[model samples]
Target: MKRRSLILPVMLFALLALVPLLATLGPRSFILAITTRIVILALAALSLDLLIGYGAMISFGHAAFLGLGAYSVAILSSHGINNAFAHIGCALAVSLVFALITGAISLRTKGVYFIMITLAFGQMLFFLGTSLAAYGGDDGLTLAQRSLVFGAPVLKNDVTLYYVCFAALLGAYLLCRAIVASRFGRVLRGIRDNPVRMQAIGFAPFRYQLTAYVLAGMIAAVAGVLLANQAEFVSPAYATWQRSGELIFVVVLGGLGSLHGAIIGAAAFSLLAELLSHYTEHWAMIFGPILILVVLFVRGGLTGLLGGGR
Candidate 1:
């Protein structure tokens, strides 16, 4: 990639890093909160882009990993195990297992069937969360405290948490970029473009695609861990089909196959929804049409307008 290609992503992160200083000048603390939320969701959407953009897998249940991560922290914290490493480990393990099982089954199908199976699995997890009465069930669960970093309340501070989220986003972006540029990425892209040809050449597209699916799940789970801490709560709704739609929208709105597009899309979607909700409770009623117009007209997404390609 050219140095100029990185300019936008670098500049965007720089702007995000400065947000804490800007928030200090204003009395509205919600600015920092919402900003953190966007970055967290951006991480989740970035994971989805890895599958949809690079692997040509349109998963409709990616939010299940997010919910799993959040619930992992919540459930573990409820048991007096709120260590950051512990939460992350549990979240990743569970997401990996879930993704392996679901992806193994879902990848057998193609196109709309794959989508429906993923959606079905996500809904199953959503209902499972709702059934856990000991963990607040339908009412959701609140954390007694955020995950502890070496027994310190690092994430308890908003600014510290914001930087942590920023670091995670940066790390996720770099890792995804590296993966997409590697020989493995080439094979995945080849599979996406021509699975039959790749199969003829001795590459098992199923195995490669499943690996990508599991990796995406694990990454999304990390976002969920941060999300649970940010909100200090976990809910079944986090894994709903609707949340999956929002993730897909973020990946698509930013442009498929471009990792940076996921970040941009998340930021735009979060800000747009925030602005619209103040005017009406049924904000989606308005936001829906706007999103449709973007998909219909913005052929390459916001990234295309900015002159980047996958």
Candidate 2:
């Protein structure tokens, strides 16, 4: 990787590491809460970057994995399976199965077809969540408690939870950085630029695309797990198409194909929403125009602006 590329992630993580300490100067609970949420969403956005940015696979139903992960925690906890590992395992297993089934079929198409199919799958899960009346249905479900670590309330502390989430974000960034720098990542990029040319060179685009899709889904699902734990609630709204759109917006806002860009975009999006909403309920009206301005004028998104172009 270029030394310039390392600059952003290094600075970003270093700043994130100081958040807990910084919180001591203000409303610590609120600070930790919002930051934890941003970190989790950033992880989700990073996974989407792997697909839309690197693999050129645009998915409109990526939020389904988020819903799956959240629901895994809710359903399992309700059934007396309060183990954190169990919830994570369930999320991964479910996300893997869903991604494999959906990706296999979605990879056969291109352009808008891929987008629509993913949206359809996401809506399917959303409707499924609404239909689960036993789990509170459209009203959503609240957890009696957070997941325990080794039968202890390790996550009960706000600061502890924040650090755990921060660690996950850091680890995920490294993992994705490794993947993007590997030979397989090069193949995905080649396929993104020209699938026909990649095929001519003896690479099967389908397998590579499908693999990327599944990996993205699983990673997003993990984010969902953290989100559920963070909010202590689960609802069908988690898988809504609007949420998926936000993820896309985040990746684009950060700059495509740049991992750390996702984190920057997520933080900007969340902080802007938080700040704007405090001033008026019509914050989205303002948010929409801001996104348009960024899309139109930001060249390569925030990362490009900061890094002097990708």
Candidate 3:
């Protein structure tokens, strides 16, 4: 009973911490813009956290879903299909099918073998995206128009787009929280913590892992759609292995198992990139070292740096 009272305080603290950031930046400033990007990337990171932190699945091909989702919108819009629903529906379905097929096979292996299989699949997907001659082929496709949300221009305004992304980020956060606490989440957690024990209790580890993988893929696809919308372009670079590494970086940065940490990590990573890039062309060289330092000393990430409230 006493422990339950801690929740409100934690929530209030997190909200309060944001006040400083918000107060210091204008709506049109780079901070806010980067923050929105953080939210978008966080959605992808959150999905990876489910597979890695909770399910113990090391997926190196996760960005394939992102690429698939991005391409779905780009390809459809190229043919004059601009409805948001149509693009999103096709993206989700395709990503789910891909996840189901890949997860089924990848879940059969473990450790380095699982890692290699997923990496191989991701590379296959990357090359596949690079082969679409109709959509810029090796150069990638540029989105001529953004999807129309029910015929209304919900995403035409930068502020509106940011809010839409924020809402999606909020929804993703809530959904993840609910999922992590639900019965299915418990089983997945059980499998992660003790696969042998879960199987001993008649629970099939592969089945749960695969289900989680598919769900993660679907969510990751949603992120892909938002990301392409955010960037206003689709490219093979979307499916790069380096992007997958960044997703894993967020999972670890936010402290494994803390869903909201994904958001914080994304904001940190993106904002850092933006700020650093403003200084020089060799920004990534600097970013790499910083990431290494974080992994070495920080351990839990920004949320942890903030006392692990949310």
Candidate 4:
């Protein structure tokens, strides 16, 4: 990548690293809490960017993986499996299976059919979650405590948790950056633009696209693990269509195709929503127009506004 491309992500991470210090100036807990949520969601958004931006697979059921990750943590913790490694392992395994199966079926279709199938799969998971009465079902489940780190309550400290999540976000960003620059990423993008042409050159577009889909799902599941730890709760609402839509909005708001744009977009969307909700309960009404204006006028979302072309 060019030095110019590194500039924005570097600055973004530097500011994020300073956030705990900045929290001392204001509502410390509130600042740490909200920013942590932003980081986690940004991770999720980043994964979606891998699909939508590069793979051109508009997955409407993306939040299903998020919900799956959160539930993995919640359900395991409830069963006395509080180990962080176990939670992560279970989440990844579940997400991998779900993504592989769904991607195989979804990739066989195109355009609106693909979108609707993803949506259908997401709703199927949502209803399944609500049916899990043993895990609180529609009511949601609260964690007894955060996942243990080698039998220690290391993540219980707010600041420690914040840095852990920040590190995960940074790591996920780097992983995605590497993937996008790799030969596999190139094949995926080629498939996105012209699958037939790619096939003519001996590349199986289905396999590449399906692999990318599975990878994106697994990454988003990790975010879901962090989210469960952050919120200390899990609910079926996490997999709802509305939540999936918001992830798409976050990607578009940040500028599609650019990994760093997802981070900037998540920050903008979360912070803007936080600011708006305090003044009015009807914030979505006002926020809707703002997003519409950006979609209509802004060429590439907030990242574009910052002079970073997608």
Worst 10 residues of 1 by lDDT: 301-310
lDDT tens per residue, model 2, 223-291: 999999999999999999999999999999888888888999999999999999999999999999998
- Candidate 3 stretches with Cα past 4 Å from truth are 1-32
Please provide, for model 4 over 1-310, each residue's C-alpha lDDT reduced to its tens digit, 9 standing for 90 to 100. Answer: 7788778889999999999999999999999999999999999999999999999999999999999999999999999999999999999999999999999999999999999999999999999999999999999999999999999999998999999999988998999888888999989888889989999999988899899999999999999999999999999999999999999999999999999889999999999999999999999998899999988998888888897655
lDDT of 2 at 53: 91
- lDDT of candidate 4 vs native? 0.94
Each model's lDDT: 0.94, 0.93, 0.81, 0.94
Output the TM-score of candidate 2.
0.98
For model 1, how does the per-residue alpha-carbon lDDT over 110-191 read when each residue is reduced to its tens digit?
Answer: 9999999999999999999999999999989999999999999899999899999999999999999999999999999999
Give the residue spans of candidate 2 off by over 4 A.
none
lDDT, model 1, position 159: 89
Q: Each model's TM-score?
A: 0.98, 0.98, 0.90, 0.99
What TM-score does candidate 1 get on C-alpha atoms?
0.98
Clashing pairs in 2: none
Q: What is the lDDT of residue 304 in candidate 1?
A: 81
In model 2, which range of ten residues has the least summed lDDT?
A: 301-310
